[model samples]
Target: MANSNLPNRIIKETQRLLSEPAPGISASPSEVNMRYFNVMILGPTQSPYEGGVFKLELFLSEEYPMIAPKVRFLTKIYHPNIDKLGRICLDILKDKWSPALTIRTVLLSIQALLSAPNPDDPLSENIAKHWKSNEAEALETAKEWTRLYASGA
Candidate 1:
């Protein structure tokens, strides 16, 4: 059976995200499917990803709030913690998730991840190696990728 509380919770959260929006992020639930959302995150200032607007998809399951939402990038990003398929290796999205966390908090965490990548625990080994071995070049490549793929904003 569908969780009766899930839809109402999702609607409240979506409304909050719209009203008091974060500085560089915006998301809206799909009209056809309230469980799916189209998300856009602007690259944090002073980060290599700055000037880019990345797209992502977030889906809430019936177990949401109790279980973490599923999220993935739709835009290509050159980051050590995000795989080519756009899967992110963030703790909150995995082992650290809590029912108290909201979509706003998760998106904020993602923005923080773009600002500070952890190459030691990486999703993209090649990008991690590049980040550790030649950070300057890696940053440049990241900027180039942002310009090519996510420069809409």
Candidate 2:
């Protein structure tokens, strides 16, 4: 009963994103599974990730809402909180998740990460070191990646 309601909730949220997306993000179902999703977000203009569309993939489990869904970037990006595997280092996605949080919330958080890079807890040590020592250069690389991979250049 309750255990089988995963697909219904997943469909509802997926439909919600399609119906009324946030200011700069879009999402759709993945080819392999309805439980899996494909998403893209236009970088906010003031952030280093600007002028580009970043891709991410999401996987929602039956226990979602009770447990945080799994999310990973499908596109290559450079930032202190994102690793080579596209895993994001956000507390809410890990230990700090609240049952009330939704896919929309997670996407917004990633967008926020772009405007503010938190080197204190990083997914890439090298990026963190550079972000701390030479912020300008680090932002340049991130911006460059957005220009290259995300902007279709």
Candidate 3:
């Protein structure tokens, strides 16, 4: 599809994302599908996932701006808030979503989630339990997983 057919909001947003990307984050629309984006987020320093590069997919539906963009992790991560299938348990991505939010905000939120994993509201019960039971071990596991899968090498 051509940019001529896309909504002005999407075009502006895409331009802003490309021109002024957020720190440690990069997002670009797919050449084949303007509505689909390929995203990469570098793990925050001091976090268990540090030095890792996580990939994600974001797709804006036809009702975008009114509806939250569909997003999912393409890289494996060992975190309580992320499930085995990479589905994330985040309020902004679900019930708390608002049209005012943008893709930059969403990706920033995901990076924050990596910095502060909320085991209390988790997507993976087992990981959550592990987090609650033995946090140090859980952090080590998360670090190991990041090294193994999200090295970006």
Candidate 4:
């Protein structure tokens, strides 16, 4: 809960992964800003997000580990998890966050979310509406948009 603890956790996890290896996540800090980072997560295969590369920006504030870090999509992705503004809707990012939630855990949770998206609890109302009204069409649209924007169609 002290200053930059969240970033420190991220940095440590990144260092650990760099030293070892973690699947589906590649996290690195920007040379200019240690508080800002660039992260890449391989889309969960067999899910609507499969074959997509999710680019994300993570911002850790001075008040960290107490307040969860801010994470947003840098890529144009269409999913129930992400809103149009790229803000991800996850409980861990919100009310449920604890200092114990590591970057790896967050990324893994995202992958799991792709497999079981909670359209009932969405960041984007429009996307949620589509998801509620026409699930198949929404999934196809999400998949198509992912191919068009996140992947080379």
Q: Report, for every candidate in turn, its global Cα lDDT versus the true structure.
A: 0.93, 0.85, 0.94, 0.78
Per-candidate Cα RMSD to the true structure, in Å, reads 2.5, 2.8, 0.9, 3.5
The TM-score of candidate 3 is 0.97
Top TM-score prediction, candidate number: 3
Q: Report the lDDT of model 3 for residue 129.
A: 100
Clashing pairs in 3: none
Q: Using lDDT as the measure, name the better of candidate 2 and candidate 4.
A: 2
How well does candidate 2 match the true structure, expressed as C-alpha RMSD? 2.8
Per-residue lDDT of candidate 1, residues 27-131 (tens digit): 988877778889999999999999999999999988999999999999999999999999999999999999999999999999999999999999999999999
lDDT for position 123 in model 2: 96
lDDT of 4 by residue, 1-153 (tens): 223544456567657756755687777767777767688877788877789888888877777667787888878877776888889999998999998776667767766787788888988888888888999998899898878878833
Put down candidate 2 lDDT per residue, 93-114, tens digits, no spaces.
9999998898888888888887
The true-versus-predicted C-alpha distance at residue 132 of model 2, in Å, is 0.4
TM-score of each: 0.94, 0.91, 0.97, 0.87
Clashing pairs in model 4?
none
Off by over 4 Å in 1: 1-6
Query: In candidate 4, what residue range of length 10 has the lowest lDDT sum?
Result: 1-10
Off by over 4 Å in 2: 1-5
RMSD to the native, candidate 4? 3.5
Order of models, best lDDT first? 3, 1, 2, 4
Residue 85 C-alpha lDDT in model 4: 84
Q: Model 2, residue 84: displacement in angstroms?
A: 0.8
